[model samples]
Target: MSLELANYEAQAREAVKMFWGNREAALAKQVASGNQDAGTRGAVTAGKNMDGFLALAQSLVSANGLAMADIHVQRRVLTLPGFFRPTKLWDMLVIYRGQLVAALEFKSQVGPSFGNNFNNRSEEAIGTAHDLWTAYREGAFGEDSARPFLGWVMLVEDCPASRSAVRDTEPHFPVFPEFKGASYSTRYDLLCKKLVQEGLYTSAAFLSSPRTAAGDGAYTHLSELTSLKTFVTDFSAHIAAVAAR
Candidate 1:
């Protein structure tokens, strides 16, 4: 099966839009009725719903090129020998060309800037990478395998916040008690560096293309907008890349 980048982008866009529309409708009802709690809960519920939609989207994208029966999306924790620590993750797992190819972590945000939620997501990605690395080192991978796994951070760029967040400036996440004094971006960068240096990741690329310098008085586009159609197309190419790995 081949990945369809355009379709992926379209589906992602539609799903997000639908999720937001539903949220807004509910919020409007609550506001008219003066239900503050409902509005508040609606915000949280919207995020959860988006997450669920993304989870399913990952599966759909994976299923097209790969056998749905063989491949698993959102694989849970499977304890490996000698690596006793358990960390459960919901990753889009691909079994391409008879080999485990990639594990994707889809992230969608309205704004460019990442808030507390982004911190959690970064932690999840880093932790999942660690677990996979440990498993591979302990001979957990199947025969005819690609030992190193790939990681992806997919974004739906719509809000100004997200635009500001992914700018060329140094990225930083807010600090929590667990991270002590380090910025979230600092921590995330360090983790990514270590993983890449250790040969855990193949190579890193952002789906959103950075704006380029066009001619005089013009701006170049950097990050590419991801829609359902785009996602399917990108998925096709990504699958091919993983197979070559």
Candidate 2:
């Protein structure tokens, strides 16, 4: 791996460790003390433990030497106007030279409830991209010469619940053949691939790390297209070319 990418890999482990830390802290704080809404469990169940994704984003932007002023990770600052919806909050946003440079979303799913959350995650991902593209086509960001870079990074827990076959029931008609007997991991892989294939995203990374070993950034990647290495490489190349000009 390139030096910059090597650094990202090392730092990815930090994200994993931070994820666990945040989870444990939230639970501990609520249990030890008397706090009801302290932990991250929610109706939507997104952004439960985001430290790892944030770290991943920080490493990427810093590696590219992006100015701190040009980046926004806060919810208020990251919200952008949309065509389908009024506005949507993004995980990370970068604007430079009066143009939207990039927008990224990070999502993760833990085990024991993969079946319930799979479709929700997919719909959210697709709808978010569709809304952004339509908004961009309608000049939501501005009259930039080119489209902004859109990225997605998903971290999935490596557990039996997520890896086992997910039963699919098609009541009226048949579903996609590839989806047959697919697990949560496989579904995510397909989702990332389709997002890029449809031009909904510039690149997408589907990463998996075990709860036990993710602290050291230990994970497995089987898909070449959606690998974190591929995502980082592609993202770095885009940043490099844009910054050079």
Report lDDT per candidate.
Answer: 0.46, 0.78
Q: Once model 1 is optimally superposed onto the true structure by TM-score, how far is the C-alpha of residue 167 displaced, in angstroms? A: 13
lDDT of 1: 0.46
Prediction 1 TM-score vs. true? 0.52
Tens-digit lDDT track of model 1 for 1-245 = 43334344444445455545555565666677776463246543434434434554455545444444244543353222224465445445555554556555655433334566566765665666667777766666664466534654443333344444232333596544434544334334444444445665543223322112111111112222222243344455565455444
Q: What range of 10 consecutive residues in model 1 has the weakest lDDT sum?
A: 211-220
Task: For residues 1-245, write the lDDT of model 2, one tens digit per residue.
Answer: 34666777776777777666666566666656665452346312324586566666656765775644387787779899899889999999878777787889988877668876888988999999999999999888877646788999988889888789877888999889989998889999999999999988999989887878634657777599998888888877776666766
TM-score of each: 0.52, 0.90
- Total clashes in model 2, counting residue pairs 3 or more apart in sequence or in different chains: 0
Highest-TM-score candidate: 2
